[model samples]
Target: MGRAPCCDKANVKKGPWSPEEDTKLKSYIEQHGTGGNWIALPQKIGIIHIHITHYYSSNPIYLSPPIISFSKQINFSISFFVFGLRMFISESGLKRCGKSCRLRWLNYLRPNIRHGGFSEEEDNIICSLYVSIGSRWSVIAAQLPGRTDNDIKNYWNTRLKKKLLGKHRKELQARNKGNGGILKQENSSSLLLQQNSAQQLHPCWPQIPVLPLSSPYTNQSPSFNDQDSIRKLLIKLGGRFSDDYQPILDGLNLQFPHGSNSLSSTQQIQEEQVHVGSSALGCMNSIGHNQVQFGQSNEYCAELVQGQGSFITTAIGEMVSSNDYSRRLLGGSLEFFYGEEMITDNKIMGACASSSCGQSTNWGETSSSLMYPSLVASNYEGVRQEMPRECAFQELSYPGAQ
Candidate 1:
């Protein structure tokens, strides 16, 4: 079965309450309480209907219930109170429902209820409470005396909300236009930093392995001595010694320094420090502590001779000695690059002939300077088409390695 409604919907009045209805509702509630049942209060206020048993009068000869009694003073007050309520129902009488009666008494006709303009303090309080807890109008209403939740809610939706929004927009626009756009700059810079941080953390970005530029242990020359030395170093550096290291560096050898004497002990307790940039000017393997050995007789000279018409030469072409160019290549107070590019009669020809692209350090200047950097260039021209660091690997001969 469906829940029964409190009143008949068709017969009850709605919309604006009449003056007479307001006055009647106010007066009735003040004189006699709603008895905690607003649904019955409407009927009680409409007309007085005393049960024949509750009333007694018969020219001082009326029969009263033998056990029932009443004080004359108390009965008279009750009669007077209901006298106004006992009027007959008319078309012009109050005809509202139970809910309407309740609402009228509580929100409109209640004593001390304020319905005029809200104060600035009230607006501030409303805005603050709304920010903290959102549209809980009843809770907000409790904070302000004499204000109804319905009134505050309507005020916020209609006017107060728009006022706050306009104020916020103006503040943001002024902040942007004044002070050299400081806020925008900080936000943009912070965003850029976050982007860079994300890129650094990306999995696809290559992890740059840390090692001496002249690592010597390449894909071609991994040996046992090198593996053992690296393992000990890693242990000293505080990392786990994995049982699986054998699969990684088990076959590496440790190349000894050239001038070392006979072993003081059976096991090589100490290894020579690899001087990557000190005297190295060509391949790390090929260069020594005090000399560079990049000459015309290097492994790839013949390839260049076959590919290009000329062998590599100094910029001034045999005028300035090779040593001077070597110093410059070593960054002896000055680094060198292709100050001027090589030009040939045929565009297809490589700069293999002692000349090529203009002065550009971008080619091979890794973060750490190569020990045997550009001696290959000084020996011939200032770095021809072949990479100067190729001597370190000493793997392929130039001009499209065979």
Candidate 2:
């Protein structure tokens, strides 16, 4: 059998001290004195000393007499007051470790430490300060009059955290509802764009030889051809790629498989990729590129096809060239695919999508979405993609696979 539990767990005495116990301890200590040692003090004064020592030992105020002086009544053993002086001298910063200093200050030296119930003003201050600083109770108590850090810390752990958490939850719900408005606006804009594109196309749209750009096969074929043209276009563009591409290509050929200590193929690949991806994203987002694509081409069909090809080539080329782009795209795609799969499998798309579709307008709201399912799905996919393909494949195909 296990050893009997240390001390009694249940029925531990709590709340305010009795007047009778107070009177016995106070009168005894006043007459006899503590006589130099805590261990022997109880024995000298009898059971009353033991009871007072135990009571005051547990109460932070008795250990720190300065704080007790703030109270209108003097209701503790005189021995406790004498003990506080010894603790202060031994544990002050002049010679004591941080632990000893903190214990001495908290138990004996700090002043005006209120031990009774917290007032409404004190509660309000704690709640408001906690919002910005979290569990810095020592800091919180410093702001309030007559309140000790220990009391504030206890009240926060037992009471304040729960209230704050509930308030936080309600704030989140309101913020999410606000974000849902922005997402609905974005969805509406996308639908409007689709409608506008439809109006621009021929009425015999079904018969027209048109394929969706979103389709992988249609996207891939043109991307393969445009990859060759992309290198030529980069040459004509006169940017970092135009300047660096030839030198990088020459470096690659010279350093095929591996290079000398002077220049490595791996380093060349990294430099070239960063240059390419930065260039592509910059050029695509520019006003100049948009004007050139739309203005130079006479036929709408030709412009659309060429523009789509350019985008696909830029995206794929950047991915192949830049490790950063590859990792980001791969991770993003994986997360998107996995999340879609999970939602499909679980059949919780409507509810999940509704929650996921919200877009925060403020920094605080956006920060909160870090814990949302949509963000989690996105991050999971992104991190998964960044992992080695072998690892990702293993994750994809596991115990369920034959």
Candidate 3:
């Protein structure tokens, strides 16, 4: 454009530095002690005048002595200190954004930074706390000295999450095994109790044959006839009289004869009659004769009546007490059932709690006590093939009875 930007003349300054020019510049800088202004010094030193570009620019048409000297001995300490101060202030106030501060600190000023793997104790604490606390890596990191939140978060994602998941799977398996053992113990205890209860009752008691009213006793003596007449009269007056008195007539086995609807409403009278018959029969037998003293005004008969009543009352009381004890055990077991639910709910709530700390969701309002037995029973049934028969008996017999 302007004479092809002028081909370099032998005496003309070149497009690039020649060896001779470079030598000349070096010698001049060495002699001048490397501190003079480039644009002014060239003219003063009788060299061709050259202009130096500003420090902020990329392309330079010429060089200046002052600019070159300043660049060589650049003192960055002040600049770095100012930058670090600003970065810290901005991070503290959360004003300049973490990304900007981190970039400035890390890229330009961070010294002796460790960029390696975490230690074993760090791994263990992280894993355990993570199981209980889930995410909240920042808080976890704070507990682990010399660790950063970002480092922990990354490690958890990449390595710890998988390891912990494996551990949790094993824990679940162990819990299932423990549950199975408990179920087996419950089953064995219930079976043994059932067998013992069955053995305690007289074998012949369950098969008593009903008899007709007109049948006479084997002994046809007048005393026997009078006793039979009294028994018949007592039965006619709504009493429960067992002709066969080989076994203790516990009220539990005193089911009225099959289809004896006439006797259902008169159970109390039947019970009284049975009591009377038992007392009368006891007096006739050798044991009975000795049990009562002659001319003693049947005080033993009265005592026997009182004892029989007490026995009936005691048996009924025992049954009721046993039922209550079973219910309490069941309630305590139900509490354990709810306790498991609470553990599961707590884990869920912990995750939610960590994630929603700043939210107004009222997580504390939830309660484990509200967990009903019905819910746990359903879950229990699914896992167990057959419930402890006694427990099931208790549950079914006392549905809403408790």
Question: What tens-digit string does per-residue lDDT give for candidate 1 at 1-402?
Answer: 998978888878889987656655665676566779888776666422222222233112112121222111121112322432322212123567888898888788888889859876677666544432235577567666788888898898777755744553354346446744444444443322332343355422211111122433222222224445555643432333222222222212223323322111211221211112221212211212111212111113223322232222211111111112222333221132222231121111222212111111111221001221133333334224443443222221111111
lDDT of 3 by residue, 1-402 (tens): 556422223323424334333432443444463343433232222222233334444333343332323212121211112322321100000112223333333322234334447765566556433321234465456455556666787887776555543543354346447666543554443322332243354221111111111211113211322444444442332332222221212111333223322111222221211100112222122111111111101111111211322212111111111221111212232223346655444333222221111112211112111122232233333323332333322311111111
TM-score of each: 0.36, 0.25, 0.23
Predictions: Cα RMSD each: 33.5, 23.3, 38.1
The superposed Cα distance between candidate 3 and the true structure at residue 117, in angstroms, equals 2.8
| Global local distance difference test of model 2 | 0.30
Q: How many steric clashes between backbone atoms does each model show?
A: 17, 5, 5
Off by over 4 Å in 1: 47-93, 183-402
lDDT of 1: 0.37
Best by TM-score: 1
Output the TM-score of candidate 2: 0.25
Q: How do all the candidates rank in terms of TM-score, highest first?
A: 1, 2, 3
Off by over 4 Å in 2: 1-20, 24-120, 127-139, 183-402
